[model samples]
Target chain A: MQNPAAPAWTADHFFAGARACIPVAISVAAYGVVWGVLAKQAGLSLLEVMLMSGLVFAGSAQFVALDLWTATPSTLPIGPIILATLIVNLRYLLLTATMRPLVRPGTEKRSAAAMWLLSDENWAMTVGEMAKGRGSIAFLVGGGTTVWCFWMVATVFGRLIGSAIDDPTKYGLDFAFTATFLALLLGMWKGKADLLPWLVAALVAIISAKLIPGSWYILTGGIAGSFAGAIAERRRGYAHQS
Target chain B: MLTSPEALLAIAGMLAVTVAIKASGLLLANRLPQTGFIAAWLRHIPGAVLASLVAPAVVTGGTAEILAAAATALVFVVARNLFAAMATGVIMVFLLRMALGG
Candidate 1:
């Protein structure tokens, strides 16, 4: 019952506008599989993985938590655990803000609710498409739903194959995050002025890691960068693309 | 290691903090002009936010992570293709494992 000839404005638009997301989805699913495999291999119970995936509904944080727990099984990483998850998922705030204008005003609450259901792939698709001024609610449903179901399935599947994912050196999975990030950064860096604040933040984040824990660097660095970027935008009287 | 009670507490706490952080932007987005201080900040948000996410993942990594990241950066810079860079990165890691007998 699929409409094959629809314009690129709907969720189907992503199929036409960008084929890259397909690989992105595969990377995410593979990571999910890695998470699934690691959960059991780390000696944690399956209930832990299922519950974490179901409730936490986060990918990077879950992987980080599993790694921490595996490395040190003596103590629970609940505090740092929660903080890490929060920090990694904090980008969603930005994603939702981008959608505010396009969202139906009457459905603000519903749209906000739907934001929680978002993930990296769909978020990228939504914001990227919207930036081009080709926004639609259908895009959200099509792309968001696709990401959501794929994630749940990927997590469940990842756990099943958790044992086989032990070779960290082999999967090249870490770079998947890196490349996606770089691509995103380049996509955003449309001008010369965007360079300075980012360099400052990178320097600060690395320096902060030396002073604080692994995760605090990200939190502090992000706040510092956002504040720095905001202030710079104010002073320069520069018009932002947002 | 947390029981159901502990897990509930952890999740609830996470939800509370996340909601609090997001609320400020949500509220400000409603109040501010479509193109003003808030909007400008928002405009810069995507690039800045993405930079923050990728920086740590790339440079602050271990041996395997770094090696793979290098390949990713190389591909992204040259190819300028998102999928190709990511795939090359993932493939590099898998190949590294195979070559190293890991």
Candidate 2:
């Protein structure tokens, strides 16, 4: 199903991707700074911050990690932490699956190499362009690089200045975490189709968080909610077909 | 600066799994079916995960948090800006906490 004349990766597309990400980059920097502040409070050292933002490089998972982090080494929940990262990032399977068209058969290795840079923001932008018949691997990488730079710099900067702010709640910084996630959830809205799954997820999470000790609520809620969505969508499809 | 060995190990683990998940999608795309229950389930995962992350906190928090969340949603809808909504929530929580004497 490959377009025979699909244009090759080029400088123009790369820069265009970067330029297109400029506005999204602002938001990336915003939450990045917040993540840094929270990470510092969560007791991550500067070197750890650099390593995480540089290597792990996923925003939502990184934020979830902070919630799971503990300052004391003896009490650190390494297993749950790793499990949470995997569960939270599992959605990438779907995101990157949509990019298969851009990967010609032989270029799988090269394209997979670039998956490290893939992010929800850039992926959405690249897909938007793809709809218009104007996307390439270069464009996706360009946007990812831009978001990466912003995330790194902003996070480090937040960690630096975060030292000065002793009491986060006094300045409502604790609320910032909830606020950011709430904003993100709102941003994911795709009309009434999302209503059921979100409600189910919210209800399950709230109940599980009360009963369970660790972050298992997140995993349960995500799986349960997504299954609910699939079931609902299937019912809607059968109704339409019939 | 590096902290404990455990921390390093955990971060390394996180890096490994994250890379694996991202790579598997592109590599396995051809083999996976384009549509079906699995596809719909996968499509809903990100939003559901995010909702899971946010909902518990909001439900468990004090009055200020619930009110601030509403404000955040309102500001986000009006401005369509993440940062602005966050700022609004922060400022609202700060003021509400003071006014409500909590």
Candidate 1 has what TM-score? 0.69
List candidate 2 stretches off by more than 4 Å: A1-4
Report the lDDT of model 2 for residue A41. Answer: 92
Candidate 2 lDDT tens digits, A103-205: 7546678888899999989999999999998898889999999999999999999888889988878888888888888888888899899999999999999
TM-score of each: 0.69, 0.94
What's the lDDT for residue A198 in model 1? 75
- Residue A39, model 1: lDDT of 67
- Top-DockQ structure, candidate number: 2
lDDT score for residue B36 of model 2: 84
Clash pairs of candidate 2?
none
Worst 10 residues of 1 chain A by lDDT: A1-10
Query: How do the candidates score on chain B by TM-score?
Result: 0.51, 0.90
